[model samples]
Target: MNDIFSVLPDLGNFLVGYVTLTGVCSLRLFMVMFIFPPTADGLLQGVVRNAIVVLFSSYIAYGQPIAFIQTLRGITLIEVGLREALIGVALGYAASIVFWVAEGAGTYIDDLTGYNNVQVMNPSRSEQATPTATLLMQIASVAFWALGGMTFLLGTLYESYHWWPLTSSGPSMSNVLESFVLQQTDSLMQTIAKLAAPMMFILLLIDFGFGFASKSASKLDLMTLSQPVKGAVTVLMLALFVGVFVDQVKEQITLSGLTAEMRALSGGHQGKPD
Candidate 1:
């Protein structure tokens, strides 16, 4: 009982740190989901799924008797607490950036593909998006989670403790804000380009085919045919690219270690990446 009393303070601190870290992650997940088109029903499903993934993994990855012993030997509970909270925020931010990149790419593709004018209500941003753009994001989010992205995320989160120790107060608001914008800009453009590549290529073929059709039928109502033709092409391209987009996002997130890296940075670590 006496020993239990002595250790209670440290244990409590660890729990606080763990919960704060995971809470930050949940918000980040929410943000990523925010830019995608989900019905209210879909959004609730996403939230619940994310909660299960986060809480279950947190216990498994961060909760261990040996880990508690390690905390006693000079690992200040405050430091551990701070680190967990900061890391959770960082991971969440990273996830947000990756999804945003996919969405940004979808936006760019819709612009170039002539689908930009067909705006629909977007639940994610509470604005509007071209059908093509919205469909792509929806597909990407589903694919990201289905392909063990969450498991990989958990592993990376665990790895973070070794690579990014929490010795600082985390990044300042200015720094985090700047990094978030800058990283989003860079990754968003790049991901969009990649996501759009296949569609863009198909569109070029489409343009040539349309031109040939017009040349062959010079007297036909070319303007009337253009809309149907373009619309058909858009639908087909979406079907083909949806799966590809998901795979690409999953690959990028896994390869870049962007989530782990970003979380470290967000938590105010000076040496962490941008």
Candidate 2:
């Protein structure tokens, strides 16, 4: 009886520590799952996704000492939760950037191919997008899975704990994060321009030829004829270069790139001690 009574305080402390660590870890993962393209935008799906992430985080966090504040309530807990959420969102945005860039490339091609008028509802995003954009988004999703991006994503999340542990205060490098975001945005635009260049060039040539023919023979509706021709050329170009585009996406959205971005967001900070 004495032993049991004496051990109660220690046991209670252990349980509290375990729960705190798991909750903090789970909070971060919940934000990631909430913002990640594959898991976000669905209420039930988000819940299920967060559950899975929390499970994985729990496994990773097992036997780890609780390095966070002991109290689950108060200003510290609130601050910690907010910090974790920010980290998760930053990581999720980094992961989703590739798909956004691919979609932008497709949108640019649509503008070149006279397909901008053919807009359809995107089920995933609840926004209207050109058919080409929708198709590219779908293809990007498939390529993301085929290229082992899911594995990379999970690994990155796991490794993030090492760089910015749950116990750590908020990220330190605000200027670095701002710069990284600006750089990524610029890179995304450049990538889209590159991807759409071939189609744009071909379509421009077709338009110029049609314009010349129209000036030569005013009675002929060259403008009307140019639309179908441009569309056909776009289809052909896509058929020929789809493999190249997928490979490029796979190369750019790599594990190393994601890890580097995460490290930058976290300021390469080590985990905090209890």
Candidate 3:
């Protein structure tokens, strides 16, 4: 029919726009999603993950014009995709920094409490980690989901398109981007110290007390007794502080610094760390 013929061209244009946008958008999402447990790769799960990313990208990119894909050539298209992937990876790993901070703080406690002597296989990573470190990492992963972290991640991804479009013909300016990473590193160190400080201080007192007892009661074998005492103390402290610890973990997991990163990516003035 004449009416069907008239609508077909518009339908074809819409399909072309959507396919191009989905390809650009989904690569970044795939990189980000794989960094989380729920979306990690398994044969069946990978397929589902792919479907979800494509759908979400399509949903988000629905109104955007993707005619820019027509302007890209072989090398240029590959360059754009590589840049998009790197951006996704960089953004994805930002989530893991909080996990690392939690694990680091726990490992430091392991050193203080003499628990580093024992290593446990982490089910998620399949690597041996000190018991406390393994525990904290698991806890951080839980807090990531329970505290709406996925929302923040997706929000950052959505906002990213505002600055770094598929049409970007060049790379993000390095000078603007440099300070963003430095600031994140500084924040990571500061967070580690903050989380570990209280436990460190208490454990130091126990060590000091044990040192004095060793001198005063030389025959008592306080060295044998001290490890158990420290273990008990660590357990008690962990129980008492875990609620607050989760709260702190919640703070670090947010991609709140992303707005600044977006501005920097676009060669705009970078904002200070949030």
Give the Å error, residue 67, model 2: 5.9
TM-score of 1: 0.58
Clashing residue pairs, backbone N/CA/C < 3 A, model 2: none
In candidate 3, what residue range of length 10 has the lowest lDDT sum?
265-274
The digit string of per-residue lDDT tens for model 1 on 1-274 reads 9999999999998777566555433442334333323312345465676765566555543544444434433336545454455445555555655566666766766775677788987555556777766666566556655666656665665555445533324446456667766876686677667766776777667677777887898888564565567678877767776666556556754434754555555463544421
| Highest TM-score scorer | 2
- The 0-to-1 C-alpha lDDT of every candidate, in the order given, reads 0.57, 0.75, 0.72
Candidate 2, residue 228: Cα displacement in angstroms equals 1.5
- Residue 97 displacement in candidate 3 (angstroms): 2.5
Residue pairs in candidate 3 whose N, alpha carbon or C atoms collide under 3 angstroms:
none
Taking all chains together, each candidate's TM-score versus the true structure is: 0.58, 0.85, 0.79
- State which candidate has the highest lDDT: 2
Q: Please, what are the lDDT tens digits per residue for candidate 3 over residues 1-274?
A: 9999999998897777567657876888889777753344521266788888888887656655445645445776677677778777767766567777888899999998888989998765666899888888877777766777777777888777666655554444364347657866887788888889999999899888988989998888787777789899999988887788877556666656655655565565332211
* Residue 201 lDDT in candidate 2: 88
